[model samples]
Target: MAHKKSFEALDRTQQDLRGNSELMGGALVILFGDFRQTLPVIPKSTPADEINGFLKQSFLE
Candidate 1:
């Protein structure tokens, strides 16, 4: 799983590139993963920070 910011950045980039304000610029996005398997790793970060960095904890979720 990736960090929320990573997904957000992708969304922003897609929006900018496609000139669409919608999520992922209304592109066809296919994601395959086991979200429960692992969380995003934040180097030198606290447990709380790591948890909060999860994609599930983001607006995209």
Candidate 2:
């Protein structure tokens, strides 16, 4: 979340830095990422491999 003015990126592997002190501190924060880059442990999850994953097993189907 480098684009965000008040974002704090977790080290993931190591914990050296924390908090949003570079700019003004705020309460609102937004994060977006690709869900496709996840574990392939799901043996029978049809929606996971399909292009319409979110809608494949949804109630709207």
Candidate 3:
């Protein structure tokens, strides 16, 4: 699984490239995963921090 920040960064980049301030630049983004199955890894961080980094916890979600 990818970090929430990673998705946010991609959204920003895509928006900049497409010149649109929309989600993923209005592009269709299909994400496949089970949050219960996997979690993002944050080295030396607490369990709460890792949970907060989940995609489901992201603004896009």
Kindly list the per-residue Cα lDDT of model 1 for residues 1-61, writing each as its tens digit. 6789999999999999999999999998898788877888888999899899988888887
What's the TM for model 1? Answer: 0.89
Q: Find the candidate with the highest TM-score and give its number.
A: 3
Q: Which tens-of-lDDT digit does each residue in 1-61 have in candidate 3?
A: 8889999999999999999998999999998868777999888999999999988888898
Worst 10 residues of 3 by lDDT: 29-38
Task: lDDT for model 3, please.
Answer: 0.91
Task: Score each candidate by Cα lDDT.
Answer: 0.89, 0.32, 0.91
- In candidate 3, position 33 carries an lDDT of 66
Number of the candidate with higher TM-score, 1 or 3: 3
Worst 10 residues of 1 by lDDT: 32-41
| Model 2 agreement with the true structure over 2-54: per-residue lDDT tens digits | 21111223222122333434322323334356434532233465653543343
Pick by lDDT: 1 or 3, better one: 3
Q: List CA RMSD, all candidates.
A: 1.0, 11.8, 1.0
